[model samples]
Target: MAAPILKWKRLTNATGPSPRPRHGHRAVAIKDLMIIFGGGNEGIVDELHVYNTATNQWFIPALKGENPPGCAAYGFVCDGLSKILMFGGMIEYGKYSNELFELNATRWEWKKLKPKPPRNGSPPCPRLGHSFTLAGNKVFLFGGLANESDDPKNNIPKYLNDLYTLEMKVSTNTYAWETPLVGGDLPPPRESHTAVAYCDKNGSNYRLIVYGGMSGCRLGDLWVLDIGAMLWTKPTVFGIPPLPRSLHSSTIIGNKMYVFGGWVPLVMDDVKVAAHEKEWKCTNTLGCLNLDTMKWEHLTMEMVEDSMPRARAGHCAVATHTRLYIWSGRDGYRKAWNNQVCFKDLWFLETEKPVAPSRVQLVRASTNTLEVCWGAVPTAEAYILQLQKYDMPLTPAKTPTGNPPLSPMKATGVFRPAVVG
Candidate 1:
């Protein structure tokens, strides 16, 4: 089922001095390559890693000059074109930078940017662990906690629900930015959520759906921004909302969005013996929702013996046209992580189209009898077959020379057809 590791399967240890181990670094695939920038593990790390998908190799094109320093949980969006933009991220000492950086593909360099001023209402403050989604040529950012203040301990944590957009304007050798404030009711402030872009109505209205994150407390609420109208709307439906979660992974498949495991709120015990007796509830459910119909459904394994992935949070999920890929993150109870086991396993989700019906033919045994034969339908939800019989008139002598009188018949039923292993 597999082959031994080859020269290409193994990669050389990273070049240049290794930076401090970091977490919450954001990655985006651009032109068949994955670019990963800073996250918060040590301080803000400025080193960037470029992974080549085709070769399974890691390449660090020697940095020519200054790059974005170590930051955590910043907004990283790769517009379909070929640019990866990085926004605010938290540094050591709990300081967040409002600086912006754009990684150029052709030159293989990073360019720092000073964002344009806001047009109307107060602009989004510099924050980390926010959500970013690119629609058309504009990138949208929403919801994260900003600088901490001590006016009052109870209300000092400012969780923002405001939305901001970075619009890229292309002109005759002149390129500028536009920051548009989103309007209408918005969801509560959230961080560490996933936001994905999907086109609606061919390419007219685009939808950016966000799910799972932490505000003052953890949340599992769903909110969407209509990219074309620049409005926010909440989805209302039946079934339990995904268990209150944060650091979960979500990706889109067609019009449906699938979310995997994440950490939920849990009580921690101060003593050892008491912790063992405590019953901890960590959700292991996988769920999805249809954006158009506002219908939600949870996924269950098809076979009883099928092995499922281990529960994890802070993992990342990315959807191709057909399959969804998941990467590593931490697992275990909220406060007590048994061990840090970052996963690198890849799984495939096979979705196939409905098979077409086979042809059917009718045989005539005599003038008054008929027999039909057809191959068994693989997934025969229902079947239809037609037959025609000849009818004789009372005055047979008149000699009806036309084709047999048509008598249509349909066979509709469920029969378990034979299946091949």
Candidate 2:
């Protein structure tokens, strides 16, 4: 079988108000837009950054109402639609918050859903690096490091394995949290792991798979939380699992979960003699976990021109159908880590391989006339060119002599050219 070639392309030359270089920030893709929030640079940042994936544009949206206090290591998750919810994070070295806030991406507004200490009075404690995953109407939050004290200044970090759910009443536009009575052998306390739900396209509730984090050192445990049963089961994962890692990001695309960029401990007995420079290493290696077979498969990734992002952890990754976008994370480790070395770059990893330049282009354009042309797609035989009347406000046109790289149009591949205006 041919290995999966990860064709990487770094995004550069983007103009507009972009967020400063930060780590521990979170990002989610809604429709065609990627929304970023929380995380830290020199200090914590509360502003919101939006990147238009289609146009390769960045805009720091002027958000209405109040944002959560500057914080990082919080729970930031998309509701798979137009809303993103945040819960519990550290404001600074000695301060943390358990406040929950909601951002309506469509309206670009922020509303505090559950206030600190919560109206229910039973919210999850102040924590960092927790999983705040949205599945259907319920958002399940699993393990993270938390401080048991009610005082914000007592920032002693304690690993927790407790579980809670916040269910949204979409009819009334409200939500509440419930501590589920979970059964089965509970996974150990940890933080910086990934908990992704295997939900339907419509965001129907499904299984929550939690994997890899750090307790004291790094962890490699695989745990599954069944939604209907309210139980946690440790699955015997097949194939060579990823090394014990923390602060990694994993996204479930279709039936496979893609894992990338995490702080991995490199003290395996088999690799004692390996010429590795560091005892711990941050890796940018990509691995796939097949949900159907409960097996992990190695994806042999081949990058074109060696353009992938470097090894880093605490970055955020989200998928738009077939494409994976990763942005900003911390790279070094231990005492060698420098705060100023955090990355601010953005990159796209094409899951498919050997990207060939598109055969479609704008052939000619005049003041009153425009002509577009395209050649056949490989193993395909049909093409369609769509020209819609320009209704959306157009910016002042740039150089009038450029062609946009073609967007793939899939069809029967059996018919000749057709144009619709």
Q: Give the TM-scores of the predictions, in the order they appear.
A: 0.67, 0.79
TM-score of structure candidate 2: 0.79
lDDT of 1 by residue, 226-313 (tens): 8778788886856656666777767776777777777665643334422232333344456777777877764444433234555667
Model 2, 1-421: lDDT tens digits are: 6674556678898878878877888888997788888788677888788898777799987788777788888898887788888888778765667788888888888888753233444778778888989766778888888876666576567899888888877677778778778789999998999999896556554889998888877777889988878788998789888887888999887788988989887776654422242467789888789987889987766654457788888898998756789999987667332263688899887664322225546655667875656653332223454444433334434444775422222222212344221
Best by TM-score: 2
- Local error of candidate 1 at 200, Å? 1.6
Clashing pairs in 2: 381-413, 382-413
lDDT of 1 at 207: 83
